[model samples]
Target: MHQWRTWHRPLVLFAAAMAVMTVVSGVGLLVDDRVLTGAAIWSKPFKFAVSFVVYALALAWMLTLVTRGRRTGWWAGTVVALSSFAEMAIITAQVVRGKRSHFNHATPFDESLFNAMAVTVVVLWAGTLLIAILLLRARIADRASAWAIRSGVSLALVGAGFGFLMTQPTKEQRAAGNLDTADVIGAHAVGVPDGGPSMPLTGWSTTGGDLRIPHFVGMHALQLLPLFLLAVTALAPRFVRLRDPRVRLRLVQVASGAYAAVTALVTWQALRGRPLIHPDGATLTAAALTLAATAAGTYGALRTGSGAHTSPSAEKELVS
Candidate 1:
């Protein structure tokens, strides 16, 4: 069992840095009165800092779990660490300068910084993909944990890619024809302007659709799915059916499907310029169907585990 001491060094250090930034930014939120794009000026730094903490720490521990390709995984982890730090630095710098970080091209300098951020994002994606490959080829001991890790990485990639959708110029931006003049280009909000009323804290669009919603949901699947698997494992003692490895794996598959559906659903909703808080009939119906399907799938998986493959003693030891 590899401990934190043996986890990826660069990633752990990066996570530690981000943890400090998280505390600093959180304090800034309480003291600073500056606002950016209808949110507190410190908001971007705080959110990004916290995200890096979760991502870097999780990635560090996960790479330690791999039995194969440790060297390649180390390189991948380093790439992710460096790129993550670059992206966070840019955001924090922009925040301090009273400027927007993403989708901003008001000045030639800002455009250059944004371009750099784009490069970092591409590198981050590639690095994550390589890590996924390592995880896929690893000789994992637990089937449930393996499935969770693999499926989580797959969904995370899909989620992170959706961020690119926001970079395309909106119809209004095209019609306004201010792109050449170095006006702001691209936006997170679909129907409304970027700086309109937003949800508290997260700064998510309230008046119109926001692409960030889906992007966020997708990216955190890497963490959420694994946590879900852990919860199931923890409850195995109470729920006899969950004691089986096969049942847990099947549930992970089902959850992965459901998670992907949510990502796609929110994406479709946003692209259609509909606010998440105000879902129409189509979205509601689709959500209902997804929930029903997941319920049925869970029932089926539980039924299969009725005839346990191993004795109770073996099952208890396996879970423990």
Candidate 2:
């Protein structure tokens, strides 16, 4: 029982949950046969729920260490956990409100609940990623870790940024000229539609999907990019002579550029009032850019064979 308190326990649990989420999400994708929405028919909710649980448990254990004055990984993990919970809350609300359906629109319930929650999640997510970046910088002496940190941070910002702004309502005036006070009163009591569509569901373009879909795409960029970065870093060169000092820096730059391109494309889609499922020229362009960056990163990593070495630094010591 005493041994369970060690970092390995929670780390293993977190890793297991993540693995389950990947498998579950993949299966859900295969079954659903639809583009993955933030609040999708399957996968997204379960994944978020699992992530929330994992983060909660990990956070509790990490915070325990913090309270006991153990500082090393506590702060970073705590920040990430808080961010995860906030994101889970937002995703849960979207799921509950049926925000992923064909009549996809946020209700009053969703707006009131998730508007503030979404912003909070984005800020916390950024802060936590920043903390991770700084930690990597302090602890890593080699170029590989630096690239990982840069790639991770860049992707997180792009993803979280899209998520934060995606919920804002379109700039349209409220519906007017509707009457039937009795129906309104009765339907309000019975949860029936008194009008043509609910307020949140009303203004959404029927032809085009929601503009917020890009934000969803952007937010997960971090998820995929970091995995690649980690893999590349893990496969380091055997010979010291193969090491490239600039490899990490280049990888980070390519990742940043890729996400920046994504952000721009998402913003363009939002402005055009396009749904997420529609693959237009701009979306294709962004996809191409991301692929190009990925290719560049893969080539650079193979060519340089750079790897990172972690050690206690002035930053770590200060926290300790």
Candidate 3:
């Protein structure tokens, strides 16, 4: 119980709440088989609920890196938790009503709910941005952890920025004279309408591009980078001797950069109405270059041992 309480800081407790929501959403899927936008009515809620679990946990873990302004962490966590919960509640309500949560303002009531959801999302975004700024400005004991946290938050912001593009009217929508009105906000799929052919379960476009792909990939950078470092720390000592912490840190940096590059490529592909499965030569070349750069960075770090050093306090933090 003490361990649970100790770990269940504001953000962590919010994550626990999200976990409960995830289970409830899963139950909703079994009980409510209604379909919306070519998917199960409960699908959006389930995805968002599970996503909040990740988001809350990531924020909770990252908040520990803040050496100053602990109260700021609490305030930020509360803002994020409340805003996210409100967004989910709105989405679930719409789903229960058998209506689309996003891009739907057919009625005044629907419009009000949609607007509320949008505002909550904006508040959540602002809170996350503030947390990222705090992490970036914070002085940590561990250089590797700091690098991961900063890079992850920076990439998350980039991912969130893509939401604006999703909100913009697509070329087809614009060509069809369907501007951003009260009835329709924006579309998600490119080159084809959203309810068209899609991959099962995920609903990503199988025939066309999906802007959400990049956004989804980029948003998880917070988990990916830090987890990568943690995995390296766990595995390196056992597999290899003379493993320098700096090299591991450098590798994490390279991986983060490569991850961001791939995200950008996918976003570009989606914007161009090109499907991810059908990448052009330019896209392939870009991907190869990113991998090559990552390899080169790793090799340089290993050979030169020129990565930033971690402080003693930071090393202890990493261990804990």
The model with the greatest lDDT is: 1
What TM-score does structure 1 among the candidates reach?
A: 0.95
Look at candidate 3 and tell me the lDDT of residue 251. 75
Judge candidate 2 against the unseen true structure and give its global Cα lDDT, from 0 to 1.
Answer: 0.47
After TM-score superposition, what is the CA distance of residue 205 in candidate 1 from its true location, in Å? 0.9
A best-first ranking of the candidates according to their TM-score comes to: 1, 3, 2
- lDDT value, residue 77 of candidate 2: 59
Model 1 CA deviation exceeding 4 Å by range: 312-320
| Deviating ranges (above 4 Å) for candidate 3 | 1-8, 178-182, 305-320
Give Cα distance to truth, residue 254, candidate 3, Å: 0.7
- What lDDT tens digits, residue by residue, belong to model 2 across residues 138-227? 534444444554454455555556543433322331132233211111111011121222123122333343444444455555445545
Residue 55 accuracy (lDDT) in model 1: 81
Residue lDDT tens for model 1, 41-66: 99989998988898888789889887
Q: How do the predictions measure up, each by TM-score?
A: 0.95, 0.53, 0.90
lDDT by residue for model 3 (169-215), tens: 77777777745354766778888888877777677887788888888
